[model samples]
Target: MGHKLRLLWAAYRKIVYVYLLLVLLPACALLYVYFHKASAELERQVAESMLRAVEQVRINVDYRLSIVLEVSDSLILNELLYDNLAEPASGYRFDQVMEQRNLASLIKSLKGHDILGIKLYVPDDKLYAREHVHFFGLSEARAQPWYGDVMARSGAAYWVSTRPQLYGAAGEVQALSLARLIRDPQRFERVIGIMEILVPETNYAPILSGAEFADDAEAMYILDRAGRIVSHSGASRIGERLLPQPQFAEMTSGRSGILRFAHRGEPYLAIYDTLQQNGWKTVSFVPARAISRPDWATSFASPLVLILSFLLLFILAAFLVFAYVTDGMVARLRQITSRLRLRGAETVGERIANRRGVILRLEQSVAHMLTTHEQLVADHYETRMKEREAQLRALQAQINPHFLYNALDTINWMALTRGASDISRMLNTLAQYFRLTLSKGRDLVTVEDELNLARAYLDIQQHRFDNFTFELELDPAVRECRIPKLTVQPLVENAVLHGIQRKEGHTGRLLVHAYASGAGYAIRVRDDGAGMPAEQAERLTSGLQGAPGPAPAGYGLYNVMERLRIYTHGRCRMQLDSAPDVGTTVTIFVDRLPER
Candidate 1:
């Protein structure tokens, strides 16, 4: 593994090198290999097809030669002919003369129509060499170039690639012929005469023409067992031996198959097969370039190479730009991280950002922490405010749990000490007062109803105190909001009992009003009667509990303040303003969002 890493770095140390090493290079190599393999495969297939084509021609050529062999076979078995032709004729007689001359004509008239010439050669004095007439004596037969191999073939015939010009027909480029020895039938080992059959080499041309391969640039040829070129695309190379070439070495090694070899510095594909019956072989040869990458292939590949090169360069450039940008970003991130550590941001962002692999998410974490801190602080202050309001609520408490029993005990003691008549009178007054204030035990009343109560009380008091006048003003919009039943009535009663009733003359004026304040409502009790100074009014409105002075005078003002503080959760306030010869206004203000 260590070695592999080192090798990788060595090969791909730079971005461009890495791209070339891993991507472009492999692709180019694969393309090059694929092109060659595809060409080779195509050539192999075409070569096999051409092999089949040549094999077919070999078959037809063999079939045509079989006809001559048949005629030769019949005459070779004739004992009477062998007996007469074995010895030179003593004199020309009608029987011997006709037999010798008619022998050539008889073989020529055989069933095979493609057979163009047939020659008979016998060692007899009566015959002279007349090659055109197809009758040759011993001198003509012994003078032929292929006379040795033909004589050596005992029973089987020898196929000649080219016949001597003396024995060829007119206009023949190459004459394919068969030469055979006529052995005495009884003593078949003794040679008596020779028979040669001739035909134009073009007899096999149709086989190649019908195939789908080139007949000009590429070639197919046949070689006999003697390694003689029996048939070729052109006849000039008929007698040449291609079997000795290094290219044909592998072809001769096996009965059939294909091989690749170089010719004239160019590669070629050759497929070969042997004629099983005759030991002859046919080879089909094709240039490798013709099958693999043709002329059009090179033309098309030029543009493709340019496009691939451009794409490779573009990719390399993109990688370089990315590296440069990310490097700068990493440096900036390191600086930010260093600053954050020194400033002590709780490093919560670092943990979160590290998990997600992003620095911006670190900022999100910091923001989240700040928001959480703010929320905690708000909650802390809210709790303290709630505690303060709870203390105020305690001040709003009225009767204690043991007050009723304690009061009954005090009444029993009072009955013992005072007269029964005095105790009975006090009980009756308290009972009537409680019944009027309870109002069937309901705790809440609309401002309109409460104002009506204040007006009714003032109506009764007006007869007792003829010196006072009272006015009631209530906003219809504020009348729908409910408050404690006695909230506005007591304030009005304080104005009447203390301020308006105590005034010296009939100049005392009382105003009881309620109006909208924010989302809640406000009630004001103003009296234009004789009012006290600010210090005296503050003394009266100071407080009911924890007082260093005497008990508070205005129970009505004290009760309203306590109720507003408790019910509104310290959201409401009551202020009393009074000056010498000036009116005193008591206002109970509420905010929109009530604690309840």
Candidate 2:
């Protein structure tokens, strides 16, 4: 037996060592390399894609600005506009009508676009074609920052950061200003007036909102030279200053390129391009984690752990097999030897002389050993059953006695002051509640009995608190379903004590509802009162059972959950939903068993 056990142990150790070296080690190394390479490749792809998105946004903004510039060119060439401004006072009624018609026609051409309304600001006089023109004092037009900038530029177009509004026939609308100095036709250097285009920011949203580098990326922005957001895809970001990030210093420095930054403990990749027309930067920010592909290194960790656990278990099982086989053989051989020696077979030579007779006797010993093993297994099972039953009984006896005292005390006072009928009714309800709690020493009881237990408890509490009320809605189909006793009463007590009793002036309402759902039954208790915090509700489901309790809320809940899980073998579930000052709902779900 010793030699055979040694051989078996050696074989198992050799196999385990060989498998660890040849299989697990190499597989882990390969997975690590694959994840590293894949992560690098994914970062490269995302960076390149962000650069492309930045360029596309730049083009879209430039295109929108160019449209305004084109409109400026058309106005500069309009002979009626120049003639009307050059001369002021000498015109008839028909000439005035024609000039107004020409100005209206010019405004009509740019309609249905982002141009909210156009105003030609002239400081010369209120007399010269104020038909579509806004006449202002010369000092006033030159005093404004935007208008002064346009005047300083001579004829160059400027995209103003100040969002101005344009009032039209329809209504007033917000717009971004694109202002330019209108030049005299003959003397190109002479600035006559300013032609300002009010373009709505909505025009840029359609193009930029569709341009996304990654799902987690911040929306793209058109930032002005001062780093203020002139336009952006997300409405919330407009008018906000873009933070001067180190990653996109090129944007703030008037250069164009991409850069990476790790800011606020998060990895960021940013790309930017300068728009030549307006000196605005088209910038996009992409979070590094958003674009990273799933890595095999992370995904393979669970499987590797499972495999290691399985390997350890296999080694343990192999050792157990060796120990059991060798030990059992040695013990059996000793027993047979002792019995044979008592029959006067002491030497190996004497035993071998009657080997056929010895073999017949060995068979009888094997049969008796098998019978003994069966009996021991049966005894262990019975012992475990008795232990569980004792635990259940202990849990059942632990229901709050204060509630019983209160009910009896209320009955005694009511009997003396009120009538015999009232005394009888309250006593009957108390009897039913205790009967359901005991359930004749059985743990399982019908759903109807459970609901009645809750009803009795609530009725007794209602007499104590005048502001308290309750409703029960039980499905007829699930009335006969068997669930553990005291399930519904504890939850109802929690509702009454913590939920309704705390509210000062308002009447509190409690609801007990049960229904069939899927292949199971669900019992729900709800209350309108000052509810529990979310974390407390979460703890009731996850951490409550193991916590040391004789606690106010935890007394019955822990026991009920433990016994329910044991009886159902972990098929049932409990959930809690709550918000402060709103309400609380506790739901218990149990799988349906075969009909009794």
Clashing pairs in 2: none
The 10-residue segment of model 1 with minimum total lDDT is: 352-361
Candidate 1 matches the true fold with a TM-score of 0.45
* Residue 305 in model 1: lDDT: 70
91-139: candidate 2 lDDT, tens digit per residue: 3766655655666677667654756667776545434334444333344
**How well is each residue in 3-51 modelled by candidate 1, as lDDT tens digits?**
9657645644696576667777777776677555644555555555555
lDDT of each: 0.63, 0.69
Q: How many backbone clashes does candidate 1 have?
A: 0
Total clashing pairs for each candidate: 0, 0
After superposition, which runs of candidate 2 have C-alpha atoms over 4 Å from their true positions? 1-30, 88-101, 128-138, 162-164, 169-172, 186-189, 245-248, 252-256, 293-596
- Give candidate 2's whole-model lDDT: 0.69
